[model samples]
Target: MGLFSIKILLVLIIGYFLGSLNTSIIVGSIYGTDIRKHGSGNAGMTNTLRTLGKTAAILVIFGDILKGVLSYIIGNIIITAIPDSSTLYISGIGGMVGGIAAIAGHNWPVYFGFKGGKGILTSFSVVMMMDWKLGLILLAVFVVIVAITRFVSLGSILACAAFPIGAAIKGNGTVFILFSAILSILAIARHNGNIKRLLNGTESKIGEKKRA
Candidate 1:
């Protein structure tokens, strides 16, 4: 009802729609295939790389990252535009809300039958936009884990779990930390299959070719 509430709602709606673009699926269709039906059945960069190729994967990464970044920007813009704002940190809250909605959309894209990627890249991009330093730290954490185990899923899981903790340690406000935690939970939940495979030592390692 209030202008602030309306702006926040608009940001969420726009962010989710942007995220629902589902870059991998779009690229797969351009190549006459459905990426979700191949490899790990994940419409993500890694699976796109395996099923399509480097170019398609790059496109997916770019598109996914773009949507995340745009969502944050749109959220910030919408909130900051409001006059006589009661909340001093409302812009940050808006950004977080938009970012999380985008991740949700990526994880379960409405445009693609509510099935989509794990939202790893989209979340990473959103966090990076929110706090570059923390984003770099998380990126380092992910790289180290993936480099050590060659398991992208494990890296993603651990990095996601660390986000809220890192935000807390950095003295972020409660809402920011809570939003980060939500992103973490969403990412981990989306990787449920990967977690099971990891426990069983059956999860595909990064760069592992799918058998034809």
Candidate 2:
């Protein structure tokens, strides 16, 4: 393969593997349990908190966030090493590709029976690395929605929905906007069950504990 192809392959492979780490699962294992079999049957930060405790949840969240940040950094580093690049736009696109790969891996981790978290935290981390301004805006939106509704899923959905709009408003390139839209769609799609429960008023609130 060519040099560019090699770089893209490396980015996707490394990013996906990093995301597939499934921090919650690893943390859960340390406690002699599988997080996916616990509360909400979801392997994520909130679920980790419900199943394990604050400490485990914090560790999982940190690991997941680092996955996104590291993927973005690794992609940019690879692209930077390549010669004959006239603009940094190529690196930006490469970083997006890597970030998307990580998000996908997080949503459906290959290491954990293809079941994983919704990718909200991972997406947020990636967006923060890509554009701090847009990241802060989305963070504000998430916090406001969660504070009012006390529904983390609602906050996540709204934040994901806002991502593409924020990118467009920030005058990001077409490729970036398109990638942001794709990420938004993926995030929302992963929360379809939560959306249904939300509409039916059966969704669990932020701090609700799952029945054993």
Candidate 3:
């Protein structure tokens, strides 16, 4: 295979494996329980916080964010070795590909029965690495929405939806924008259950513990 192809393959493989390392599951295992069996039954940061506690939740969320950031850095480094006139562009695309792979892995982790987090934190980190301006904008929107509505899922959905739009407004390449859109779609899809509860006014707000 060609050198570029080999590099791309390596990026995808590494990103997937890294993403598959679900922090919530790992933290839950340390406490002798499966995070997926508790609270919202979703093995993401919000669920971790609700099922576990602040320490475990913080660790899991940070770990997930690290997965995305590291994936982008590693992919950028791998693609940088290619001798091309468009090295910057190639690296940017490679970084996005790696980030997307990580998000996919987080959503459907092979290590956890194809079940994992909703990928919001990981996507945030990835977008930050991809474009800090866009990332900050989305972050602001998320914070405002969550603070106003106390609905973490709603905030996450809105932020994900804004990614592609922000990318487009910032004149990101078509491929990058398209990939962002795909990531947004995946995030929204993962939150399907939350969407249902939200519509029915049965969704859990941030900081509200699940009832026994």
- Best candidate, TM-score-wise? 1
Model 2 Cα lDDT, one tens digit per residue, 1-212: 66777788899999999899889999999999999888898889989998899999999989999999999888878866876544434648677878889999999999988899999889999999888889999999999999999899999999999999989998997888998999899889999989998998888888888633
**Candidate 3 local lDDT, 1-212, one digit each (tens):** 66777788999999999999999999999989799998988888888888788999999979999999999888888888666554335438778888889999998999999989899899899989988988999999999999999999999999999999988988998888888998899889999998998998899899997633
- Regions of candidate 1 where Cα sits further than 4 Å from its true position: 87-89, 210-212
Report the lDDT tens digits of candidate 1 across residue range 152-182: 9999999999999999999988878888889
Q: Cα lDDT for residue 84, model 3?
A: 54
Backbone clashes for every candidate come to 0, 0, 0
Instruction: RMSD for all candidates, in order, please.
Output: 1.5, 1.8, 1.9
The better candidate by lDDT, 1 or 2, is 1
* lDDT measured at residue 72 in model 2 versus the true structure, 0 to 100: 89
Q: State which candidate has the highest lDDT.
A: 1
Q: Score every model by TM-score.
A: 0.96, 0.95, 0.94
**In angstroms, how far off is 136's CA in candidate 3?**
0.9
Query: Residue 10 of model 3: what lDDT?
Result: 94
Q: Name the candidate, 2 or 3, with the larger TM-score value.
A: 2
